[model samples]
Every structure is written in structure tokens, then in C-alpha cells.
Target chain A: MSLQHALLGVLEARPMSGYDLVQFFDSSTAWIWAAPQSQIYPTLRRMERAGLITGDDEPRGPKLTRTVYSVTDQGREELERWLSTPHDPSPPRDPFLVQALNFDTIDAEKAHAVLEQFITEQEKAAAEAEAHRQRLLNKDTMLLKERLTRRDPAEHDRIARLKAHVFAGVAAVARTRAEWAREGQRLLTED
Target chain B: MSLQHALLGVLEARPMSGYDLVQFFDSSTAWIWAAPQSQIYPTLRRMERAGLITGDDEPRGPKLTRTVYSVTDQGREELERWLSTPHDPSPPRDPFLVQALNFDTIDAEKAHAVLEQFITEQEKAAAEAEAHRQRLLNKDTMLLKERLTRRDPAEHDRIARLKAHVFAGVAAVARTRAEWAREGQRLLTED
Candidate 1:
């Protein structure tokens, strides 16, 4: 559902073919919402059936017809409703944490390797999110610039910051998990 | 697959019926790994079929029967392998963050309400994780005590701390998000 809403928000900026939409998600917006083309295509069809979006086949070249999608009035309304409505908090599904929790079952050397790898993974994630957050804030990304044009000039600052908030949250969570991995490593005691 | 390993970890401590396993998950362990009876039952059967576990029908009452599950030697090896293996980092799929990212499409008043609700939900989650982290440290939970008995007396403290590490990570992430929500509200700026 969120993926559909995310796709609508992107298409709301400007109409795009499914190929462009896939590229958009894969590039600038993948940090917040990453959907494979397999999921994206099927969901797009469902959204069209639901009358939230419209898709029309347009000729790209001699051999290919690309289906371009645009958010309908209903889609805009749906996106607004989704943005305003409070969302259910994501439930805890930390498989990595569960793995760490069972660290007592493994030897100290193996546990050390696991904890060190976890730290590396979290640090890498924190770095990626922080970099993307800066891109949005600087309006360096093409999509953010595109999104800004649709908003009033006076409102553009707030719009970019709103999206940047999501990345900041991602970075903060990754950093915290990295620190917690350190805490878990300390508990080993080597006895 | 992690759920299967988590279930193995718990059953490794002591044999339990599916009903008891479900209740255990609903209570002490839900904070880390939660699976509804629907998922647990099927996965347990699948594990049995795979020779990772064995379930034997036991007499419950007059003309009544219950199945109790025990981890096999193969299951213990599987759990050990999983504990030692590095887990893939969970990809970011924050629907709430996705909702916030599109807040530019909503009114300020509605955005304020959404942010406030998120703060409240995150605060409640932080409090729950902190409480459970304390329970693990104090050995207040029956499950932790049972788990400890299965380990060497010398290793009990480290074992408990390993589990508590997961809850601590959960609490830290929740606290960070609550703070991020505050940062987001400051961006509204009302100009």
C-alpha cells in the first residue's frame, strides 16, 4: 500500500512511463521505498484498476509501446488522505537482532566475527542514508528539483526538509544499531 | 527462516507444545520475534518434515491429543550455523517515513497531528523495550531463567545479556525516531 502511495506521489510530480518510474525508484528514492519492477508493474496495474491512476500506451519507437502513467484526481486525493492519516507503527521484525540474541549458542571467535560484520553493515547503511539526505537538502537530485518546481517557491524549503526527515530517521536508527552491536560484543566476557 | 531459528532457540531450552510456544511468543518473546499461530504452526510442521525438529503426539485427556515439539540434533546444528552466519541487513521499508516524505502534499495542521501521533507511538515502543530489557537483566522472565539453566552456570550472565542486547537496540532506535519526529516538527516553520 505504501509502495503504491509512493509511486503515486512520484507520478504526481509528472507523468512517466513505467521504465522511468522504475528508474526513479531505483535511483533517488530507493532509500525510503525500494520496489522491484516485478512488484511495481503489478501494483501499477492494480492501482489503474482501482481508478487511482491512469495508464495509456504510447509509442516509444518502431517496435515498443510504453505505458505511461499519471496520477488521476482520485490518486491525488488518495495520496493526500494517506499523508494525513496516522500510520500504524511498523512492528518489530529484527532478524539480525534475533541472530545476535542467540549469540550464546556460538563460540567467542564466531560471535566476534558476527558482531564485527553487523557493525560494518550498519555503518555502511548510516553512511548511505546520510549521503542521500544531503542530496535532497541541496536539491542536487533531479527528482527533488522536479518535485520542488510543483510546489510554491516559498514552500519548497519545507517540502525538501519533510522528505529529508525520513533519511535522517534512517541514519539515526542505523547508528543506534551499530552502537548496540558494540554493547552486545562487550557482553561476551570471554569466560 | 529467522523465525524458524528463533523458534528453535526457544525450543532448544525446553520442549513445548505448539499452544505453549504460541503463548510464550505472545508473552515474553514477542518483543523480538513474533509469529502468529498461523505462521508458527505451519513452520513447525515444515521444520518437522525437514528433520530439523520432531513432533510426537501425546495424550492430553480422554480421546484428546496434543503434539509436543523437540529440537533434533540437526536442529541444534542448524541453529548454531545460523548464529554464526552473518545476516543480511533488512532493507528500509518504512511506510510511516514514506507517509511523512509526502507530507508536502498535506496541510500543516494535518501534518502536525500525524507527527504528534508518531511521537506518541514511538515513545510507547521505547518504554516497552526498556522495560523488557530490564526484565532480561534481572532474570525476571521465566523463559530467560529456563534458558539459563540449559547453559553452564558460568555462562548465564553473558547469555542473558546477549538477549537483553536486542531489546536495548530496539529501545535505542525508538528513542531516535521520537527525536527525529521532533526535528521534523521544527521544520514546519510556519512562514
Candidate 2:
């Protein structure tokens, strides 16, 4: 599915081992679209079987071989097609919001506690997103560093600006959630 | 599952037929948690078998018997437990943001078009959410009306405030997304 396209998009940048891709996903794309390490190996195998990607074996140590994955031209075409297509927005499914909708079922104290906990969690998430944004802005991230090393100078700027914008978007969402939680807390406590 | 809990929570308010529950979900809870009519009947059967809810048969017409479902005492306890428990925040999975992260793979014009389309969609969503919030604020919703009729006068304000807070929270999220989309469009268009 989209994970396959995501893998193709990442490999389109440069050849990477399955381990490197997992690291990349964790460091960069975890906030937007996460795929566990357990899913990565099986997906890589499936993509290879489908001819979207190719795996080349390389010797890592004595009696050990590692497979490095790279996207084929067909994969690049598929990535482009997916990028151009419009995607339906995912349906909202916030459990905290669901709880808020049914707040009458619980006492005010319990509701206030939930909002407080949500605020704390949201603030922590916003801080992490801000840190990640700063890294992308400075081009200090491994993903961006790799792109800068391999791509044209102009393309590097495009990539950095787009990626930084995505991180900023993430940070904004986290901040909004925190603000909403604070408002809920105030409503629960105020006269 | 959360859907089961959601059904129980709504039934705790008042008894509802399966058809009525589907309408309720479509009008109110769809913003937070969505379940299709197809899944609703099957889940209801399972819940009844499990003794979480009870359905009383009533004559609808000459030949049809409608079942009105209400949460049992066990269902009420289950709902209270769920309401008191803290839920983990859902991980983000925005496909637009995912495509934005890989913007270098696509042409600049295509990227700009995508961002523009996103902005339009987000603005529409924000407007819808704002309308919903206004309805909650004005106490014009059927759900709120029912609660006002049944609950104590003192509890009415608390319920309205909490539910309105949830709707406001939804509005805020939509506005944030629209803002993010606008920013993305600007980034795409800037020199």
C-alpha cells in the first residue's frame, strides 16, 4: 500500500539497507507515517518480489551478508503517480475527544484529570516536534544531510524547505492539541 | 473495542434502535469515531450475546418488530471503567504530510497543485467544524436537547460545557490543518 510507496520514495533518494531504512523511518517519518521494524522486513521482501525494488547482497562481516535496497525506474514512476494523486483525508479518531464527547458519564474531577494529562503529553510532543523542526531547518538531520550530499544545490533547498514545512505542520498540530486541552481544563475548573 | 464502548456510552443516555443509533453516529459521533451501518448491527448482536446491552422488542408496524437497545448495569460499569481509564494518544498518519515529506520526487507544479487542493479541502473542513461548534454552543443539537430533558439542572451546564469544548477542540484542529495547508502552498510558490 502506501508503505510500499513510502519505501520506494525513500530508496529513490539513495540505496539503503533494510536497517538503514528502519533508522530513517524512526528518525524522520515516524511522526507522519510510522512502520515498525517488524513490518519493514516483510514489506521489503514483498516490494522486491513485485519488482518495485531490488536487493543486492553485500558482505557485512565474516559469514554475514546484508541486503541493500534500491528503487527501480518502475518504482520511481509509481512514486510519482502516487504523489500526484489526491488522497482522501483520514477520518478523525481521537479517543480523548471521544471521552470528552461523553464527559457526562464521568465526574468533573476525573474529566479534569484527563485534560491535565492530555495537556502534559501534548506539550511534550510539541517540544519534540519543535526540536525535530530545528534539526531539519539547520540541515543537521541524517536524512537531509544525505539528500544534500547527493542532490543538486537547488534541489537541496527544495527538499529542506518542504521537510521543514512538514515538521512545522506537526509542531502546530501538537500545539493546537495542547491549547485545546488547556481550554478543557479551564472549563472544567472555572465558575 | 472502542466502538463497543462508544455504543455502550450512547445507549447509557437512552434506549435506541439500531436504525436510530446509525443516525446518531452519522450526525454526532462521526466527527470523533465512525462506524458504518453494516458494522453496527453485527456489533450489536455480539454485544447482546455478551450481555453488555439488552434489546427489547417493540412493534414497529403490522409485520415488523423493532428492537430498542439500552445499556445494562454491566454495560454501565464497563463504560464507567473506560471513562476513568487514560487512553494513549493515536499516532499521526497524515498522507498529505507524507507526500509533502517526499516532495523532491515530484515536479514543482504538481506539488503546488497538491498543496492548493489541500488548502481548499481543509478550509471546507474547518467551516464544517465551526458550524458544528456553533450548534453545540447554542444548545441546538438533538443529543444536547435529550440530555437537558433528562439530567438535573445543575448537571446540564456541565454537560453542555464539556460537549461544547469537544466541538471547539474539533474546530481548532481543522483550523490548524487549514493554516498548515496555506503555509505549504506558500512554500511551494515562493522563489
Candidate 3:
């Protein structure tokens, strides 16, 4: 369902085809909402069927045709509804944390290995989110530039700041996980 | 599924009826793994069918028959496998952050309202987790005490510590979210 809203949100920013949407998702902004090509096409189809979006076929070459997707008026209304609506925070269901809860079953070496693995994973995620946040702040993004043109010039910087802030929140979360892993490691040593 | 592993994790510590398991999840530890009774019954059925658990009919009274569940040797093996395995980090799909990514569409007051609501939610989560962590550390929890009795006396403190650490981690994550919400609220004011 979020994938649907995110798709509509992106289309509202700038209309693009499924291929371009895939490229858009693969870009630095992918950190915001990551969806695979497989998910993208099926969801776009569903959105089109629901009348939230529309697809127009155009000839890219003499023999090639591509469908460009854009948000319908209904899509914009849905987008606004989503923006104003309160979203429920998802419950945490981390398998690693579940494993950590049972660290008493394993030795310090094995448990330490588990915590270390978690550290690496969290650090990698934090690094990616942090890097993306930096790129967003520097205004070095292509897709965001396109999005900026859709709004007033006075609103451009805040838009970019909003995106950077979101990614920074992502980085902050990953950092907390890494810190938690380290704290778990420390507890193991005390045992 | 993590739910299966969590169920096994609980039963391995102490076996209980489906009703009792439902009560257990509703306890303070509910913060760790939140599964509804609907999900619990169906998942128990599936796990029983898979031979990971066994259900025995125990008569409580003249008219009441309860199916008590316990983990099998196979379930223990699966739990061990899960503990040692490095679970992949799930991708972030936060709807609030997704909304923040599109805040440029809404006014400052509206966006501030969004961030403010998120702050209240995060703060509530943080407080709950913190209280649970304190309960866990003081050895004042009913479930953890039962779980501790299953292990050697020498290992009891460490086991409690492990549970406390997990809840602390949860509290830390919630605090980060609340802080992030505050940051978003600040950004809205800056606009």
C-alpha cells in the first residue's frame, strides 16, 4: 500500500514511464523507498486500473513504443489525503534482535560473532543513508532538480531540506542499531 | 518466520497453552514481538503441521479442554539455526518518512501537525519501552523469571541482562525516532 502511495507521490513530482521510474528508484533517492522493477510494473498497472494513474503509449522509435505513467486527478487527491493522514508506525520485527534476545543459548564467541555481524550490517546501512543525505544536501541530485522545478523557487531549498532530513533520520536509525549492537557486545564481555 | 521462532523461543523456555501463550504475548514483553491472537493460533497450527511443535489436549475442567504446545527437538534445532544465522537487514519502509519526503506539498501548519503527531507517538513508544526495560533489569518480570528458572543458577543474571539489553535497544530506537520527529518539527518551523 505504501508502494502505491510512494509511486503516486513520485508521479506527482514529475510524470515518467515505468522504465524511468525504475531508474529513479535505483538512484540515490532509492533510500527513501526502494521498490524493484517487478514490483514497479505490477503496482503501476494496479494504480492505472484503480484510476489513480494513467499510462499513455508513445513511439520512442520507428518500432519501439513505451508507456509513460502520470498521476490522475484522483492520484493527487489520494496523495494529499496521505500527506494529511496519520500513518501508523510499523511494529519492529527484526530477526537479529530476536536472536539477540536469546544470546544466553550460545557462548560469548558465537554471540559476539552475532553482534559483530549486526554491527557490520548496521554500519553499512548507516554509511549509505549518511552518504545519500550528504548528496541531497549538496543539491547534486538529478531527480530532485526535476522535482524542484514543479514548485515555486522559494520552496526549492525547503524541499531539498525535507529530503535530506528524511535520509538523515534513516541514518540516525541505522546508527542506533549499530550502537545497540555494540552495547550488546559489551554486555557479553561482562558475562 | 520470526513469529515461529519467537514462539519456539518462548516454549523452549517454558511450555504453555495457546491461551497462555496469548497471555504471554500480551505481557510487557509484547513490545518485543507483537502478534495478535488471530496470528498466534494460525501460526501455531502451521508450526504443529510442520512437526516443529506438538499439541496435547489437557483438560482444565469438566467442560474445558486446552491444547498445550511445546517445542520439539526439531524446533530447538531451528531456533539454534536462527540464532547462529545472520539474518538480512530488512529494508526501511516507514510511511511517516515517506510522507516527510513529500512535505513540500503541504503548508507549514499542516506539516507541523504531522511532525507533532509523530513526536507524540514516538514519545509514547519510548516511554513504554523504557518502563519495560526497567522492569526487566529489576528482575520484576513474571515471564523472564520463569525463563530464568529454566537455566542454571549461574547463568540467570546474564539471561536477564540479555533481555534487558534487547529492550534497552528498543527504547533507544524509539528515542531516536522521537528526536527525529522533533527535528522535523524544527524544520517545519524554519520554513
Candidate 4:
């Protein structure tokens, strides 16, 4: 999604400063859709100009003023409208697969080396993904336990199950990529 | 990897016209890195100007006068240098995750509907991946059987095992995602 849409979504949740939006993106959706702080602030300004969102509620700071943004009626209408539109998948843009396709051009030895390198990168990435997935799982578990304590046992179970499924999907993908790497290494060594 | 390095790596194997590079990228490396033909042809001309690659001995045709490219010594050195460098992971850019992160902000029912839509999309993607994995498996199986017939089984075991592992990994991931979709449907219905 565009940074604009992300910012708008955050504002729809609650009136948040640009800094808050940045923080939300980093801690919550960092793994899936991340944008730089640089992009966030500018998009906030642009959205304000377009009247999609506004920041009339400014929290005062001794040194600088922090603007808290809320979705205007127009903004909510836009988000509701955007939500109805079909979401198309972005075409894949993987470099490794590109190399693999034309691999016939390179000699076996050279292609093998590239494949080895690809495996190494995939391993590292899988490790990081696993770590992130674990952290999210822990957080989800804690949140569910808290909800259970508050007598909302149903909500706890509901969110926990959803969280589990999402992270399970992520973990599975990482595991698969790692397996692919090991297979790639074996192929390179043999031929 | 930059488009420049990827292009050089392809040429290092054998000289190819820009058109061929574009086609190769679509078929193979489209998974990793992708560049349009517009980007590929211009980059080739720029690489030529930079003395990284030179033209081939023969031209294919007048209109289709393919400009064959081979890596120069400088290009080879550059590609090798790139190979030695550590890789950086391209961050995931999934819009659905962005939307989900703010699910509490919007109408819960609407968000649930959006997620249901994503499940359908993920199912389609998983199906495509599974199909491709099966194709790879079938092709490798055929080649392995052919090798057995010829009694030249030296690399057969290695190739077969590697291909099998990679396909298994792919199928596993796809299955997990499909499972997630089923479990997720239950969670969405709970609220």
C-alpha cells in the first residue's frame, strides 16, 4: 500500500501525531509494509493539504509543536471507497529467479557459485523472519492472556487464533525457503 | 543486486541481445529481480558506453539486429566484486498487512471482509507456486529416468534429490498458507 493509505488508516484508528504513525508502522507492521519516517511526515503534510486528513489538534512541546492527525469525514469516505476496490498483487520482482532462468548463459561453475550465494542470503533472511515471527507470537499470546483475564475470553481466542494462523503462514514460508537453500547447495556441489 | 550487476552476470555466461535478456528475465529471474525491456535495453547501451561490455562478431538481422554483449575484463572484475559483498534483504512490501495492522481503527466487519479477500488472493498465489513446483519436479523426474535408461547415473541421484527437496519445500509452504486461510475463516466468523 502507498504510504498515504497507511497514514490514513492510522489516523482513522485514533488521532495520532506523525511521530505516532511512524511508531505504529515500525512496531506493528514493520515486517510486511514499512515506510521510512521521512516518507511518513511528508505524506502527512500532503494529505493535510488535500483535506483527506487534518491536524488542527496540535499537542504543544516546549521546543516544537507536534501535530496529531485525525481522518476528516472526507478521509473516511476515501478509505471506505478505497477498501471496496480490488487489490491486485504486485508482480514479483526477484533477482535470483531472473538469474536462474538465464542460467544457461553462465558456465556451470559460475552459476553454481551464484546459487550458493543465493542460498546463503536465503538462510539469513529465513532466520530473521523466524525471529520476527516468534516475537509477534509471544506478543500475541500475552495480549490474548490479558484479554482472558479481563473476562473477554471469546475475543482472546478469536484474535489468538487469527494471529497464530498468520504467523504460522509466515513461519512456513521461511522454512520452505531454507529447505530450498539446502537443496540448491547440494545441486551446486554435485554438478 | 542492481540491474547493472544482474545484466553483467547474465552476459558473463554468453553474449545475448537485449531482447533475449528481457525474455530470460521474465521466464526465470522474474521471481527475484525484474526490469522492463525499456529499462534493459537502455542499461545495455549505458554499459557499453561505460566499457563494461562489448558487441559480438555477428549481427542477427537488420531490424532485429541483435546487439550481443559479452563481459569485458572490467565487467568480470566488477561482478566478482559484487559477489564478494554481503547481500541486503529487500524489505517486504505487502499492503494487506498495512491494512490489517489498523483493523481496530476501522469497522471490524469491514476489516474481516478485506482479510477474507486476501485469503482468496493468497490461495491463488499458492496454487500458482504449487503448479510451478510440480512442473519442476516432473521435468527433473523425466530427466532422471532418462539418465537411468542411458546407464549414466553419476549425477542423477544428486540432481534428483536436490530437485525433490526444493519442490517439497515449495509445496509445504503453499499447503501451510492454504491451511491458514481455513483457520482464519473461523476466526473472522467468531466476531
Candidate 5:
């Protein structure tokens, strides 16, 4: 995702300090996207310089001061323009799969260990996705469900069903991969 | 995925010219990973220089000669070593999602138009994935299924089921996403 657009999104919602925006990302969108504090701070300054956001000076103790940012009308317009434009395809790069396919060159035991490590990492991801889904469910899911329940029965039901499907699919894949790794490790040990 | 690893994968299966490696990528792994011809050719030359693969001089047309690549024993060993290593997380960075997040800043109609274009592209992907799945179903899938069917009903069934799940999951997700896009288009139009 474009850092600029994401910056504009939070700003458009409400004026916030760079720190606040960083917190917002951590809490709200960290599941699907993540940005380091380093990246957030630099982008905030750059956006202010570009006139996309205006920063209000807020004094700190002695040396360091914070700047609260609000999206400029131009920034909002730029975001809108971007939204209307055709999207370019992202460059394909997946290092993990690369490692998987190259396994034949390495020791079988090592390949098995790597797969085990991958399973561990995926478990963490699955946990994070679960937490994010729960937060979303808490915030908006009930309201959406109520609205859908009252509306077009079939369409609403389908959409309601799909939200469940997406979550289940992600969880199921993670669990299955973990199982495969465990079995692979066991079989490797036997060998 | 790393182009270096992908090249080795094709070589491990059988020796191939740089041209043939490119063709293999297009036919098989292009869905999960892709490397441009520009990147592939340069990498092949580098791999040869690094002693990863040896280039066989084969006669082409009148003037040009083809260089076929075979993985060196060292290269095979290197690939094996890599497989045993833990997979590094490669975070997804999608520009389109960035645009969507800031969509409120743009003209709603234009934003919807962009989504419409994406739907068209997704439809194309759905078709391609369906064809691929069908091809696999006819060949490798049947072999897998036969193995599953003839094996010990309890012991062999679990692994067979898991593998089937992976293949089916990919196909289902693609089909569902395409349907979601179509429905989303209608929602945008109505709005």
C-alpha cells in the first residue's frame, strides 16, 4: 500500500499527531498492513512538506516536539485521484516458496526443519489474523449482521456467510500446514 | 520466489536451455511466482559464471547457438542447504488496497470505475486458474486420487485428504474472489 494514501486515510478520519497515527495503524490496520515507527515519522514530515497534511506544533519537554497532522484538501483530492486510476500489478517476490522449491539440493533433514520453522511462523500469523478478525467482529460485525438480517435475505445471508468463510479458510490453511509439518517431521525422524 | 531457485528447480527435474526454463515458468509456477525474461537471462549467465550450472553449447539456427543449463553437483548441494533454512517472511505490499483506503477522497463514480476494471482483470484470472485446475485434475490429480483410493483406508487417507484440500482450496478461493468482485461491482453501481 502507498504510505501516502494510508497517511491520508487516517488524517481524513481525524487530525492526529504522528504518534497517534502510528498508534491507529497498530490498533486498526496492523492485521493487513504494518509500518515501522521510523517509516511513519518520515512519511508524516514528507507529507507535511508536500502540503498533503498540515502539522501543528506541539511543544514537548525541551528538545523534542510533536506535530499533529490533519489532511489538507489537496491530500484528500490526491487520494481520490489515485483511487480512480488504474492499478499496476505488484512485482511478484516470495522468498519462502523459493526456499521450498530448492529443497532437493539440501539435506532432507534440514528441509524438514525449515518446514517446521515455517509452520511456527504461520502459527503466529494465524493468531494475529484471529485477533484482528475478533476486533472487527466486535466493532462492526453485529451492526452489519442486523442490517443484513433486515434487508435482502439471500444476498445478506451470502455476505454474512462469506465473512465466516474467509476467516475459516485462513485458519484452516494454517492449521493444515501445521499438521503437515508435524507429520513430515515424524516421518523424517523415522527415516 | 527467487529466480535463482526457480532456475535450479527446472534443472533438477531435467537440464534445459534458458528459453526452456522461461517456458516452464510460464506454464507452471507463473501463478505463484514470475520473473521477467530480462531478469531470467541475466541470472542464467551469472549462475553459469558462479559454477552453479554449466552451459552446454548446442547448435541453434545458422548463426545463433543455444545454451542449455544443467545443475552442477555443488549447485544441487547449495539448493538442498537452502531448503533446510527457515523461510523469511515477505510481507505483501498492495498498492490497490492503499487506493481503496483513501477512496473517499476521489469521485465516487470514478473510484467505482477503477473497481470495475479490477473485476475485469480478476475475471480473467478466474478463467486462467480454472483452466489450470482442470489440466491438473486430468493428470496429477487422478494419480494422487488413485494412490489414495488403493492405499490403507485409515492410514493413507489423511495425507491424501490434506493434499486434496490444498489444491481444492486454491481453486475455491479464486472462484469465490471472482464472484465477490462481480457482486461488488453491482453494489458500486447501485450506490
Candidate 6:
């Protein structure tokens, strides 16, 4: 599964405790591939059982121990194989679009309100994505900087450019969503 | 839960056999909310148990009968409530973007090829969405025509506009994806 590969990829960046991985996902990978903390612990156990990752107990404080995860050699090979493989686009699952398809059941006023709210939410998302794009471009984000330091100097430019490309893609999607919502609002108001 | 509501909405249009619903989902709703044929039968049974839908056996031949499903009053009321509720945006689960984030692990040429393939797929999808939008605008799609005939004449215009809005939204998303892919391709090529 892609989640397994994603976990391997993240662990390959640096050894992280489950708590740290959850924080990393929330702060960075949430925009790309989100996984809830509830799912993380179970998945980590599975990955360990499958020999893709190994967990070692480390002292956290006077009496506390935490399990820190790191990718195995097998995991690195698997992550690379996944990276080389072509990706299939995911199935459509947009609920707002589903509602719009059944618009005959709702009033025009309610439809307009929904469109407006969608536009507002999309605008906020676009702003956040744009800010993220700027952070990637500046090479100031923590994940980007850490990845840069870990890789060969020859890879520095490619890594920075590719990551920024992903954020730019996210911003474009948000802008298009906002644009579509505005168009829907206009259609509701006109005629 | 959204899938349940989507099923109810489709049934509100007209009674359909499970087979017909599978065909409908494949032809029409696949672009908005895809449901597998495997899930359809089980979900239909669950809905029957919940009293959200009623199934009546109709003779198809001398010895064979088919169950046709239609929305109950409770189903319609539930659908209306769902339509009135605000929707939260689904989290991103794009694997290609995840790969991009870990670009340091992949060779540049492979990344370029992947971006090119993605662009081609998105361009094809955008064209199909555009064609669907045109059909909705002309009120020529079978589903749109069916809903129009069943609803009040005064509601016809609103229904058409709303449906077209959904397709337009689809078109915008596809176009944005294509654009992002193109940008990714360029990033891979330059420097």
C-alpha cells in the first residue's frame, strides 16, 4: 500500500519516534498524504511485523521509554521501487460535487449559500498552499532543509525544485476549486 | 456515509434494479463518487434493513424475479438534511505528490517520465469532462433529462444550472491537474 511506502519514505529521512512521526505528518505531510495518529500506531506495528521497519526502545526521560522507528535496507529498496513505479490516479470522492449533481432537491438560495461557503473555504486553502509554496521556494522549511543536508550535494537543486513543484501543484488545485465555486455562485445568482 | 447518501439521491430520481444502479454508477456517477459493484448489493441490503429504501419484487420472466429499489419518505428526508449540511474538504491522498516530496530518492529521468505521463492522463480527463459539461448544458444527458421530466417545470432551469456547475467544477479540476503536471514536467526538464 502507498501508506506503507510513505511511512518507509518518511522514516528513511530520519529515525523518528511514533510521537515525532505524528507531529511530522501533521506539520508537513498532511498536505500531501494525511494519516491519523490512531492509524499510525497500528500501521507501525504491522510494518515492524513485515520487516519493512524496525523499532528500538530508547530512553525518553528518567523512567519512560519510547519506540523509535527506522527503515530497514529492504524498506529503502521498496521505497525506491515504489518511486520508480507509475502511479494510478485515485477515484473521485468529492461530496460537494455530489450535492451539486442532485441540486434538483435543494432550493436555489441554499445552493448559492453553499457555493459561497465553498469559495470562502477554498480561498483560505489557497492562501495556506501559497504560503507553503513560498516556504519551499526559500528552502527554509525544516523538512526541505533536513532532506537537503542528508542528500549528496549533487541532489540539492533537484530535491528543492521537485518539492516546490509539489506545493505549486497543491496551490493550483486550491485556486481552481475557488474559481469553480465562484462560477457556481455566479450561475446561482444570474437568471 | 456519503456513499449511502449518494445512493439515496440516485434512487430518489427513480426506482432502479440493483443491476441498473450498478450500470448507472459506472456510466454517470463514476466521475463524481465511484462505488464498486461489490459494495452496491451489500449497501442496498443495509439500506433495506434501515428502512431508508424499499425493494419490491417484480417478475422479469416466468420463473425469475428482480428486486427494484426506490427511496422511502425517510430516505428523501435524510437526503434533504445531508444536502443542507456543509461539507468539509477531503484530505489529500495524492501519491505522485508524495513521491515528489521524496524526490531525492528518485532519479531525475524517471521523475520526468512520470510527470509527462500524468500530464497526458490529465489532458484526456479534461477533454472528457468538457464533453460531459456540454451535454449537461444542452439538457441532453439521459440522467438530466430524467430528472427534468420528474421535477416541476419551474425547477428545471435551476436543476440544469446546478448540474452543469458540477461538471464545470470537474473540468476546472482536471485542467488544473493538467497544468500542474505540465509545470512538473518543466521543472524536471530545466536545469
True contacts kept of each: 0.85, 0.64, 0.60, 0.39, 0.39, 0.69
Each prediction's RMSD to truth: 1.5, 1.7, 1.6, 5.9, 7.9, 1.7
Query: Model 2, which residues run further than 4 Å from truth?
Result: none
- TM per candidate: 0.96, 0.95, 0.96, 0.71, 0.67, 0.95
Candidate 1, residue A42: the lDDT equals 91
lDDT of 1 by residue, B13-88 (tens): 8888999999988986776777788989999999999999999899999899999999999999999999898877
Interface RMSD of each: 1.6, 1.6, 1.5, 4.6, 6.6, 1.7
**Model 3 lDDT, residue B79, Cα:** 86
lDDT tens string, model 2, B38-74?
Answer: 9899999999998999999999999999999999888
Give me the candidate number with maximum DockQ: 1
Candidate 3 chain A, run of 10 with poorest lDDT: A25-34
* Error in Å for residue B121 of model 1: 1.4
Q: Which residue pairs show collisions in model 5?
A: A80-B105, A80-B106, A94-B1, A105-B80, A106-B80, A106-B81, A110-B84
Error of 4 at B170 (Å): 5.8
In candidate 2 the C-alpha lDDT for residue B7 amounts to: 90
In model 6, pairs of residues that clash are none
lDDT of 5: 0.62
Q: What residue runs in model 5 are displaced by over 4 Å at the alpha carbon?
A: A16-28, A37-46, A86-91, A98-123, A140-191, B99-120, B136-170, B179-191
Best candidate, lDDT: 1
TM-score of chain B of 6: 0.94
lDDT score of residue B108 within candidate 4: 53
Q: How would you encode candidate 4's per-residue C-alpha lDDT over B1-191 as one tens digit per residue?
A: 47888788667655787877898777744434657888898899899898999977565566546567888999887776665443555676766555554443345567667767766766665665566556555644333344345434565454444445443554465566556556555666666
For residues A153-183, could you state the per-residue lDDT of candidate 3 as single tens digits?
8877777888888888889988998999898
Q: Higher-DockQ candidate among 2 and 4?
A: 2
Q: State the C-alpha lDDT per candidate.
A: 0.85, 0.82, 0.83, 0.62, 0.62, 0.82
Error of 1 at B40 (Å): 0.7
**DockQ, every prediction:** 0.76, 0.68, 0.67, 0.31, 0.24, 0.69
Model 1 regions lying over 4 Å from their true place: none
For A1-191, candidate 4 gives per-residue lDDT tens digits of 35777677656646788787788777655566668898888888889999999886664766667778888999888776665444765666654443444333344567667666666665665565566556544644333344345445546545544554555555566566656655565565664
Off by over 4 Å in 4: A57-59, A96-165, B12-14, B57-64, B102-175
- Superior by TM-score: candidate 1 or candidate 4: 1
